[model samples]
Target: MRIRPVGAYALLLDCDDPDHVEAWRAELCRRRDAGELSAVEIVPAARTVLLDGVPDPGRAAARIAGWTPEPVTTTAAADRVDVPIVYDGEDLPVVAGHWGVDVPEVVQRLRDTEFRVAFCGFAPGFAYLTGLPEGLAVPRLATPRSRVPAGSVALAGPYAGIYPGASPGGWLLVGRTALTLFDVHADPPARLTPGTRVRLVDA
Candidate 1:
């Protein structure tokens, strides 16, 4: 891991991978809640975590450098969300071909996998989820759609994502859900924040 100052009061930790980032973020969040670390935000990305609004970035960096974080466990029942989905996407056959499986097998595999939110990006409440095995990774479309409808469940590389709003996207659409992923009027706008576990159920 490489730690760099982001500004006057923040530090960005570049980790080895997404799993490493998640582990560090989990530990940092635990410390913050336990009053062992002081920070306003602990934001995670594809391969990094940003510790923002720290009182002393230098000291915090030194402290973090000496600490070791364990792997994150996502077995908490409270953090799990079940999303009802209709597996009738335009790219469903394409995905099945890529996986060398039939359409029904594709749906069964998706239902069996437990996904975790790695980060949020692209648009509001759009979460980049990780959990699909590396071997089952799929490629993006050769050409992106001009407009993808909201709640489109898609897969790209090793990540599974849900389109939060109607927008242009390149990911392979495999299913769709009706759950409101983002709501400005809600207490916590995004339903799938980082570390939240997700299960896609057949609707």
Candidate 2:
């Protein structure tokens, strides 16, 4: 695991292989449980884990380096949220055709595999999801869209994501879900926080 101390309280660990996911997670979990790391939160993505909370970054990183944790058994614990979707995205057929699968089959695959918010980026509440079916891992459009409607379910760069708010984007849109993902008035403002679990349902 390649570790970097980010800011005052976060220890960033970058993993080179998917096989290292559990091993890296186990180390962090051990430190957190033992109170070796006073992290306010722990955020893990496809290739990285973040320990958020500490008085000093240097001290935290040193402390973490000394403790060798037991092996870890990694499980996605991603919440299986069912989001109703409309199969009317402009690129739905193109994606299905790209994978040589029918439209219904594409939708089924999307809804069947629960995805985790690998990270939130490009916009608030827009979560990059992992666990996309191998068949559905399509690339982004060559040209970006000027504005994608909110709740648009899309895929790009081996990751899936929902459009939280209108913005220019290049992801291949597979469908549109009715779920409202962002609201500025809400307590947290963004519906999809990092580490959220999600699944789509054809409606």
Best by TM-score: 1
Worst 10 residues of 2 by lDDT: 71-80
Model 1 stretches with alpha carbons more than 4 Å out:
none
- Score candidate 1 by lDDT: 0.93
Compare the candidates by lDDT and give the number of the best one.
1
Candidate 2 achieves a global lDDT of 0.73
Report RMSD for candidate 2: 3.5
Q: Which residue runs does candidate 2 get wrong by more than 4 Å?
A: 7-10, 17-35, 40-46, 66-78
Tens digit of per-residue lDDT, candidate 2, span 160-194: 88898788999988888778787889987777765
Count of backbone clashes for each model? 0, 0
What overall lDDT goes with each candidate model? 0.93, 0.73
For 83-151, candidate 1 gives per-residue lDDT tens digits of 999999888899999999999999999999999999999999999989988798999998999999999
